[model samples]
Target: MRVVLQRVSKASVTVDGAVVGEIGAGLLLLVGIGQEDEEKDLAWMADKVAGLRIFEDGDGKMNLSVEDVGGAVLSVSQFTLYGDCRKGRRPNFMAAARPEQASDLYDRFNALLRAKGLTVATGTFGAMMEVSLVNDGPVTLILDSPA
Candidate 1:
């Protein structure tokens, strides 16, 4: 599993012109699942995202976790993250999990985030989505689960 976490002031996801998920004062998580990912991978990545101390604190230091600032999460499935572009001119997505497995893991990952007491919103698992966000600090980070 992997995720691209973008700190955001606000974010929303639209599918077929209908808004499906939205959040305020939080991170926009673009998630991807690999063939080797399992329950432990989901658990670990969720904890990492929730406990990441990227938010600023009282002294304006980046020392507060999302939990400390009372933030939400907008999780978006992003199989494209696994695209391998090392060869030729086209990106190969062979590392991405099959849709059936990937979808289940994606749902589980979101459920883990929600269980952490943060409001978690999500985009449709396999839909083409238009995601909009006001990137706070433009802070972005990439996280990967160890196999």
Candidate 2:
């Protein structure tokens, strides 16, 4: 599993010109499921995302987790994170999980985040979504589950 996490002042997802999911002062997550990803991967990622100390504390130090700051999460399914573009003009998605498996894992991952006591908003799985965000501190990080 792979996730591109961006700290945002606000974020929202639009599908077919309609807002599907939105959040204020939170993290925008572009999540990808690999073919080999399983429950363990989901658990690991959820824990990491929920506890990552990227938000700044009172002293202006990066010491606060999203949970500590009372921020929500905007999780979006993005299989393109697994795209392999090493040798061709077109990106190859062979490493991405099939939709059925990916969808199941994606849902489970969000559920895990919610179980962590964090408010989680999500875009429609498999839908063409337009995501907008105001990146806080422009802080972004890429997280991958242990192999």
Candidate 3:
């Protein structure tokens, strides 16, 4: 499992000109499930995301987690995160999980976050989505589940 996390003032996902998911003052997660990912990966990633102290506190220090600030989450499925581009101009997506597996894992991952008491919104799995966000502090991080 891999995640591209971005702190955002607001974020939304649109599919076929209709808004499917949206959030405010929270984290935008571009999630990817690899072929090797399993339940443990989902658990670990959810725990980390829920506890990460990337939001700023009153003193202007990044010391608060999204949960602390009562923020929501906009989770988007993105298999491109696993694209391997070492060979040529074309990127290889062999490392990405098949749609069935990826969809199941992605759903479980979001459920895990929601179980942590965070409001989790999600894009349609396997759909072409347009995500828009105002990145707060331009703070972004890449996270990977432990092997």
Candidate 4:
């Protein structure tokens, strides 16, 4: 699994001209699941994302996790993160998991975050969606499970 995390002041996702998920003062997660990923990947990614200290502390240091600041998460499925464009103009998505498998794991990842006592909002799985956000520090990070 791979994830792109962004600290945001506000964010929202819309599908079919309707807002489905939104948040304020939180992190936006774009997740990609590989066909070979297992529970261990999910566990590690979930733990890391929840405990990451990317937010600022009182002295303006990047020392607080999203949970520490009472923030939320806007999770979105992002299979394209696995797109491989090494040899051609058209990127190959062979590394991405099948939709059914990806959706199941995506839901599980969200559940794990919620279990950690953080507010979690999510974009519809397997949908054509529009996501908008105001990046707080424009802070962004990418994480991938161990190979």
lDDT of each: 0.96, 0.98, 0.97, 0.95
TM-scores for all candidates: the values are 0.98, 0.99, 0.99, 0.98
TM-score of 4: 0.98
The whole-model C-alpha lDDT of candidate 1 against the native structure comes to 0.96
lDDT of 4 at 2: 96
What does candidate 3's lDDT look like per residue over 7-81, in tens digits? 999999999999999999999999999999999999999999999999989999999999999999999999999
Q: Tell me the tens digit of each residue's lDDT in model 2 across 53-112.
A: 999999999999999999999999999999999986999999999999999999999999
User: Which scores higher on TM-score, 2 or 4?
Assistant: 2
Better of 2 and 3 by lDDT: 2
Model 1 stretches astray by more than 4 angstroms: none
Q: State the TM-score for model 3.
A: 0.99
lDDT: worst 10-residue window of model 2 = 83-92
Going through the candidates in order, what is the number of backbone clashes in each? 0, 0, 0, 0
Q: TM-score of the candidate numbered 2? A: 0.99
Q: Which portions of model 3 show Cα errors greater than 4 Å?
A: none
